[model samples]
Target: MKSMTSRAMRAIVTVSLGAISTAAFAQADYPTRPIKLIVPFTAGGGVDTVARIVGEELKGVLGQSIVVENLPGASGMRGAETAVRAEPDGYTLLLSSAGEAAVNPHLFKNIKYDPSRDLAPISLVVKVPNVLVVNAASGMNSLDDLIAFTKSNADKASFSSSGVGNPQHLAGELLNRMASVKLTHVPYRGAAQQVTDVLGNNVTATFASYLAVASFVEAGQVKALAVTSSERIPSLPSVPAMAEHPQLKGYDVTNWFGLFAPAGTPGPVVDKLNKAVVQVLSNPVTAKKLADLGSYPSPKQPEEFKSFLATESEKFKNIITTADIKAQ
Candidate 1:
């Protein structure tokens, strides 16, 4: 009987040791297969471009292929939800825009995943400044002019956005709230269409990524009124920021992109991804490429990025409430 008891205890100990060994090996051999990086927006947009660049760099750094998948729908909810439900093996990750991670939670009534609980923030990839541009023929020149025009024609003036509850929409809503003006919102299928509409004078104005409409603004096809950043963008120094506008007191809204992994991914795996991201964002070439697109590389540590997202989520929640924005 004593011998049998001893054998049982030894077997239990061996099984525990084997389990520990397998877990350790799994952590060390993370990404032994290709990794999927899901972008919650359409291809050729700012978020998609950043994901491809970072994914390519990660492939080189991790010695594994990183595949970028664009699953654009429901203002980036579909792709984000897919990433949230993926196995927490560090093999499937998300590259979500600020709207998906920060704003959509407050705007949408039913979210399939919680940003804070279902996903782990890896790093902030970049922050893109959204510029307020109007068709040159529309005669909306400066921030003051736009505000006056909107106020004077509150019922008639309209603003275009990539979609309802997107960053562009939020920026416009925030502006209306702060400036005490009313502008009808015209939601488009995508940013490309929004830009085209603004350029064609079919819409009164639009707040979009400078990279998307910089050429049109520079060519005098569209007039840049103000940026949503706290400071002037390097690419468009002449245009002032929303904060610079007296009527837009304390207003600052910039779109951000970040990386996330499903919750329960090992800490070491998260660290590995964070390290690779920091290395990529810190590269001068990468910085320049992002800067050219009217954005700046963030490259924050995982904890800091997570904290930042929490704060941004709170901020957007307040904005959505104060602006009286409703889901459509």
Candidate 2:
């Protein structure tokens, strides 16, 4: 009886090994069909823009079509949940921003998926700085003027964010904490609406992704005061870094976009996807296109991105905890 039991266990082990080998082989030839890249934001937002840019370039390298599906809602939770529920076959990739992977998990109490547990970090695509902008006619030319205005007209001074718990919202909170101002946060459904309100002067200001606000600033529709980065971006060379101000001495917030797949995806498949992403990002045309949109290619290996996500997760957690941030 003991001999029979041992034989059964050995047979099970052999079958398991065979299955693992087969799956690895399958992953080696990944994306037999069109891969779906999910963007967890509305169309024309920074996330969607990055998805389309990378998706188009990725197809050339991977030799498969990439379908960018926008599933914007729930402070980016709905799309994340959808991606998490997808099969771990490497075909369902998610283009997630800092808020979805780092900020929202801590801010939302009833979040359906934990990014660290439910998603596999594929690559860090780009890091775009958030800009502080106001309507060109707001007559608030500099960060100082805006601060003074907010301080004096506390009730009327408002800042718009794509939504609560978004990196833009946190940047606003950081500014409030660091500058000792009381600008109210007005969360909008998407950057489009927020930009519209800010451009119309219906909102006092907005801390939004540089990509979302770049055209407006270029067209003189909005005036950019400062960027939420330690250094000024090349695209907006004249804009000063928020950290340069005495009031916001240590302020630094950048909105980063990265790729993720559902957890448990085969390592071989993840490696292939990462390789393809690296190739696409290294292309000069792709880099130029990204730069034109106020974003620069910032790719990282799968393991590096995983580690970076862990670091960002902790960083945002500290920010959320210190700011007492909550989703509305």
Candidate 3:
């Protein structure tokens, strides 16, 4: 009986070693074929554009073609759910946005997958800050001025956002709480119409992604009051960050895109993907292109990216809960 028990234990050890060796070999030869990158938004959108750009760069690094697939719906949940359900192999990846990865889980009830549980964050591709803008002719030149104006014209003051649950929307809500002013939210389906309305003075102000509104800001159609970031972005050096003011001291809201693999993917495979992305982001040409879109291509390794997402998730959760934000 003792000899039989010892043999059983040895057999188990041998099987375990074999499995580990197979996993190691697989990781070493990852992307032996073309990889599919799932972008959970419509083609030509910010997330899709980023995925295609990164995919082009990654193709050269990995010596494998990256096929970008668009799966747009459910506030990005559809594609995300698809990615989560994919096999935990290195070939399938998700090009995720702050909405799908951090905000949507809290915004919508009965979300199919928990980002923290089902997705492994690889790297933060780019982060774009939202800016507070008023119609150029609105006569609101600073954050203080905007606050005072909103207070005086509480019934008339309004702000527009691309959508109800987007980061820009939350940023506006946060401002309302922090400054004790009531600027009613006016939700739009997309940035183009929202910016056009703001320019036409249909809304008193708007909180929008810097990239979405940068062209108008440059054209002098909208006056940027403050950016909702910790510091001033290099591209818009003249605009101050909201945190610079004492009343809005803790304000920081920015939209970011990240690369993710289904949870339980091999660690070495995740590392290889991270290394390839880090190299892509480090390229000057890529950085310049991202900058042109008012996005900063800042890549963080797997663990670092995971930590950053945690912080962002908490921040959004609080804002959504306190503001009583709900999915549309």
The alpha-carbon lDDT assigned to residue 2 of candidate 2 equals: 100
Model 2 — which ten-residue stretch has the worst lDDT?
23-32
Residue-level lDDT of model 3, residues 212-320, one tens digit each, is 8888988998999999888999888999999999998888988899999999998989999999999999999988888877788989989999999999999999999
Which residue runs of candidate 2 sit more than 4 Å off their true CA positions? 1-14
In Å, residue 152's CA in model 2 sits off its true spot by 3.2
> Model 1, 46-144: lDDT tens per residue?
888888888888888899999999998887899999998999989999998888899988988898888999999999999888998888988777888
Best by lDDT: 3
Residue-level lDDT tens digits of model 2 in 121-237:
999999888889999988889999999999999989999998777788888888988899988989987688999999788889998877788889989999999999888998999
Which candidate ranks first by TM-score, i.e. highest? 3
Which runs of model 1 end up more than 4 angstroms from their true locations?
A: 1-3
TM-score (C-alpha) between model 3 and the true structure = 0.95
Write the number of the candidate with greater lDDT, choosing between 1 and 3: 3
RMSD of 2: 2.5
* Model 3: lDDT of residue 266: 89
In candidate 1, which residue pairs get closer than 3 Å at backbone N, Cα or C atoms, i.e. clash? none
